[model samples]
Target: MTSQPRPGPAVFISAGEASGDQHGAAVAREIRRELPDVRLFGIGGRELEAAGVSRIAGLDELSVMGGTEVLRRLPGFFRLQRRIEGLFVTEDVRLLLPIDYPGLNLRLARSARRQGRRVLYYIAPQVWAWREGRARKLQRDCDRVLTVLPFEGPLLERYGVRTEFVGHPLLDAPRSRAAAARDRAAPGVRMTDSRRVIGLFPGSRAQEVRFMLPVFAEAARQLARRHQDLDFLVARPPHLPKSLYAGAGFPTAGAREVTERSWAALTKSGTITLELALAGVPMVVGYRTGGLEWAIGRRLVRIPSIVLVNLVAEAPVVPEFLQDRLTAERVAAELEGLLGERAAGRREMLRAFDVVRERLGDPGCAARVASHAIELLARDQESPGRLGTPC
Candidate 1:
């Protein structure tokens, strides 16, 4: 008697924040495009929901940021870990792709690997910055570390990990200011004045908002005092209530649903900086943390550049004021440099963004990542040992 064939492999994904959700959704969509029959499920948010990923748990609850805050949510985090581990054991997913939530995703990868599932880590954890030793741990746990930055490849290779620079996801975004300008033409809300828009991106995390919004508001007030023609838009995160900003004393043009084009942002560093660069919106990056966190991080983080644009360009294409430097005066000064003067230097920086855009390779990162995850699953089928029985 002929036996029935086993079904196509299932791929599980875990993306904990809005940015991860965005990247994960894109990857899921690409996965669907490439392998229509493969079952895809796991934890994600609205973007992943739109991308056809069935959710095991919502990301909103897991969106805590910073060292102390993450410690506060340890109980909830452990509960989520157990749930993912349960899936790895019972459901036996063939591949697990943890997008960017390293703290959570790294643990999930180790758990999945123990259960003999192939693990592909996309957006390699910032071990180069803080926990450099985790590179060895990742090399041990993950099947392949797919990094977005060019420099990360060499760094991880030094640790004997299989790594790939699949190009940055930002490159795949709409990179032309003209494209953004065109997209804006069809907008519903009419701005009081479209002359020059100043974006305020406090950040997606509540702690970031707590630290940055007041400073950003003060900077905005300073900007308004100097130039009244400029309009201000705050890029609010989905998990946050509009009242949060209102409570912070930030004057919003009423809380509109935050979109990619909310403003020419005074951004917090990370993926959003790359997004703004691709969107052709000029920005000044800022970051601040608790004093203890800052002191510890200052000692540990070895990289010269913290913001993605700076790292990708291997130079300071945009201003980054971090820690104590992230003050209203510094932010306002940088903002003035970007918007106030419109000097040749700013124009040159915008031109440099074009090169940065070219380097991002393509917006097909989600699709590429999905395809790679499928390949890893297939490889796992041929040799189960390869998932963890590393060379």
Candidate 2:
């Protein structure tokens, strides 16, 4: 009898929040396209599940951010780390795809190396902004780093990590522009009906949503008093329960739709700001963490601008509020200026949006990442244990 075909290579991925889940799903979709029979399992949210990646480990367990919060969950983190390490060993996994959650994924990468697994880190960490020391560790742990930002390649190269600029995945896979155009052109749709809609993205994490939504709602309430026709839409992450927004006042939409319909967005600074920028929606960025974490982060983070849009452009395209500066009244005032009625302000923001989109590069980032993974897998088969060399 002819010998059976060898089994497809084993692989595992890990991502932390809903944003990571979305990007992980994008990468998985492409990986499936390249290697139809490849094993794709990961710890991510609903989006990854939809893209054919099974959630062997829960995303919620790793959803937390902030130093104090992370410290509180050290025991659980250690136990989870052991559980993941055991899975990698037992599965005989050949590859590890760790997306944007650098805090834990870096450790997992080291463990993967120890177990003879190759790692391709998608969406390199913000070492350019904070915790610059981690890039040196990344060089030792990961086989290659696929970065979204155009500038990150040189930065990581200096630290000795083999890196590639995959371009921003969002640029290649824009959600709102075409859909918003179609919606505007549809027979029944009317901008007047929505009436100066404002999108609010408090955040994707449960703790962050709980902290920011109430404050955001209050700002919306105040803005409503000045502009009676103003409507509000909260962009809900797929992983969170609607109960998270139970008392917080606003209609809800998927993150993509919120970008399509809103004239302005009141946002918590995060990766979603890049989405908002891509949508060409003028917005005010703000965030709050536990007081101690905020204090600690302030001391550590070197960047003057926390908003991704601002950092990418190296210009203050939008305002940022933090700590004592982030207040309902202050946010309400800033958002009121970005309202659809403020033609001058909205026009200026759109000009800034064009600059961001150009820097982001075009779509097809997912496919590039897939190509990298496929090449890495082929090499692992070629050399067996010599898998960690620069890809």
Candidate 3:
């Protein structure tokens, strides 16, 4: 009698937001290249779907910010978590690859580990910023943590977590040489009759947009009154509807194009700050959330700077107006410095960005992360008995 064939290995990835989706997609593509027959599935957005990952749920369903926001969606998240954990058993998933979205992904990692599945975390949770205790949890749950930031690997290693510095995926992004050169040469100097563009990047999530866009719009109006040559370009995430940006009263476009054309920017504090920095655009960072969320975050956050660019630079290279400080007047005033002809703040930030880029290391980051995950999978197959030891 002919025997039934054994099922191939499977990887379950969870990337809960736009940036994570982008990074996860790149890694997924690389994994497919190396292991063509491997089963790939995940919870991500269009990018991951395009990369051949069969999504159990779209990123929008899982993406929420702030404490209160997450609490309201907690029941759905719990149900989704249960469903995903059930898939580990039914599908015989060999690995759980989580990309960011630490709030949910951390719980999933613990669950996957409990089920004797290997966990490889990408773009590891910023435990260094707030809950340093989570580092120990990562040590216990994740088989390996692939970090994008240069400093994270060292930090995680201290907690006994296996770590790899995979270089930031943003370095692989296509950059506009013209834009970089202009920013480096002029440093936001607005010449006679030359149109200068200031990009407004509120954020990717609906909640973030709701909190930031109106304030950003008011800031734009204030700036417009002062500078006739200045034009506004809002960087809209593709997943969000156009109506979300309608109140901003600016032409909306993709983040890449907007960053390339921008002389300066007023942006939300996140990975986009790093993206703008890499593109050589000086920016003023702002973030606002529900009052309760802001209060809790203020108490929990241990770091001096929340902006990634500033954190990477180890200095406050960009002005951050967060929570109550995130007013239209403050944002406009800070951006004004960035737009001036001989703005020291602008030149200093541009110079710091150069150092930040060099520190991030070279590209091919996704390939490194993919290889690490694939290696972990191979090890598990070779020594199936070792899978449940650490957990």
Candidate 4:
């Protein structure tokens, strides 16, 4: 008897922002490592490309943030979705991996499901925050919701999605300490010093850069007045123009590098805050959205906190300044307090970080997702997208 021929290895991944790029790259990297012959293709960034994924669409093509940004980029989103749906049919896509960027992924999931394809949504959408109705739609559209956050499983499962809390992808990321020691030259300037470092991550989206970088720059300027020994490192995400951070006037580095070196930081409220937390860097999280968007979100969001570190720990270890509260003076003051708040204060915060570490589960998240992908490849379910258990 002859052995059956192996199925073609093709997985479609979509990651529309810097954070997703970083994450999707890791999963792609792991999938390649585990199954050497597997082929990965997607819409992602430089990181994903480096991880061996062939990009049909660049991150810049789909990267948009804020309600206003999404509205303006609607045509581009539709075009990309249609093109991806076509690829699913043409390439015989075995599995669909949509890493965050829900607005587009949900539609893509719906289309892929119509094609009788399976979708594993990494970093599940914030239906818990707003649009609770979509949770059920996600269940209907996806085979498995591979969430990184601990709270998502219970919430999404309650709504009927087959969910798995695969810990956070950041847990499997390369150590900040290992690479932070290198005084590498990046988009802006090079860092070479013994002085302590403070990271200023204003966020990776263009809208976030526009709304937050000036405030961060001014705060950095003020903080420099008092702490002359401190060094500032800003993370410049891929696809952004070099001029984007030109006014910030600080040495720029990759986020992972800066997170390792920074003793304390004033960062935009997002996934970077949680990455910093995992690295044991105490932070003051800040964010600003369009006035109308902020007002509407404030009413709709169910959670009391926006900072992921605080949400994951179920404690206020990281301070947050949002919208009207994200003023330069206040941010500078918070950073000052965080840096000089005494060694014990930093130790106490780091101790709380231990809780965050525990909550995120262990590393090897991508490896597990890779295993799930392999299983999906073998099993052809004519029913909905549901696969087996998360392991």
Kindly report which residue stretches of model 3 are placed more than 4 angstroms away from their true locations once superposed: 1-7, 183-193
Q: For residues 1-391, could you state the per-residue lDDT of candidate 4 as single tens digits?
A: 9999775578988998888888888889888887788878898898899998889898778767778878888887888788888888888887899988888888988887777777888889888888899898787888788888888889988988898888888888766642343323232343455477888998887778889999998999898898888888888786788798998889788877888888788898878877887776878889998998998889898987898888888988787899999999999987787674345566567778888989999998988887777667667534334433221
Candidate 2 per-residue lDDT over residues 167-191, each given as its tens digit: 8988765566544563344333445
Best by lDDT: 3
Which parts of model 4 have CA positions greater than 4 angstroms off? 1-7, 178-194, 341-344, 381-391
Give the worst 10-residue stretch by lDDT in candidate 2: 182-191
lDDT of 1 by residue, 1-391 (tens): 9999876568898988887887888888888887778778888788888888878888678778778888889998899899878777666688888987888888888888788788889999888888888898888888888888777889889999999889887666553544355235533444444566677888887788888888888898898889877767777766777777885454454212322444456878878877777766677888998998888888898888788888878888888888888899888877787663346655666677788888777566766787788788778878876666642
Q: What's the lDDT for residue 268 in model 3?
A: 94
What overall lDDT goes with each candidate model? 0.77, 0.83, 0.89, 0.81
Error of 4 at 186 (Å): 32
- Clashing residue pairs for model 2: 172-363
Give the per-residue Cα lDDT of candidate 4 at 175.
Answer: 62
Give the TM-score comparing model 4 with the true structure, all chains together: 0.90
| TM-score against truth, every candidate | 0.90, 0.93, 0.95, 0.90
Task: Identify the leading candidate in terms of TM-score.
Answer: 3
- The model with the greater TM-score, 2 or 3, is 3
Ranking by lDDT: 3, 2, 4, 1
